[model samples]
Target: MEKEYTIRELTKLCHETAQEKGFWDEKRNIGEALMLIVTELAEAMEAHRIQDQANFKEELADTFIRLFDLCGGLEIDIQEEIDKKAQRNKQRPYKHGKIC
Candidate 1:
């Protein structure tokens, strides 16, 4: 049977690979990781704008990878936080103060 990987497991793998590559060195900071996440978001946006399905998918993956790496580095329980946020959102009003 194939093993199903959890978010935490994937994040740990990404963090380990980053460390091996020297990208997650002692000099690296959360701010830098966050900016890289933002950069990936921008790439995703551009891909969407250009209607490039492949690039869009790749960029989206990159964004998630960066996010996971950041969470791992910070030792954050992202799954718990996501669950809490989702539960809190359930109590929010429809559209939640949005104009749309």
Candidate 2:
């Protein structure tokens, strides 16, 4: 069986890999990092548009990796934030009071 990693673990792993690859050799530009993640999502959208299942899945993974790396670099506790947001969302009305 494969080992399961929590979101925090994945964050650490992704950040460590990025650092090892010299992504952190110098101070990073937050805007550029964010845009790169957006680029990955765009790639995923293109893959989905063409029904390229394999590439679509890979691009989705890339998105998460980039997000995790960002969270780790900033020392943000993503799991805790997710839990807090989810709890708050649970108290909201259907669709957060939105139509359509």
Best by TM-score: 2
Screening candidate 1 with a backbone cut-off below 3 angstroms (N, C-alpha, C), the clashing residue pairs are none
Off by over 4 Å in 2: none
TM-score of 1: 0.85
Predicted candidate 2 versus true structure: per-residue lDDT over 1-100, tens digit per residue: 9989999999999999999999999999999999999999999999999999999999999999999999999999999999999999999999999998
RMSD of each: 1.9, 0.7
Model 1: CA > 4 A from native = 1-3, 97-100
Clashes of 1: 0
lDDT of 1 by residue, 54-75 (tens): 9999999999888887788788
The local distance difference test score of each candidate is 0.87, 0.98
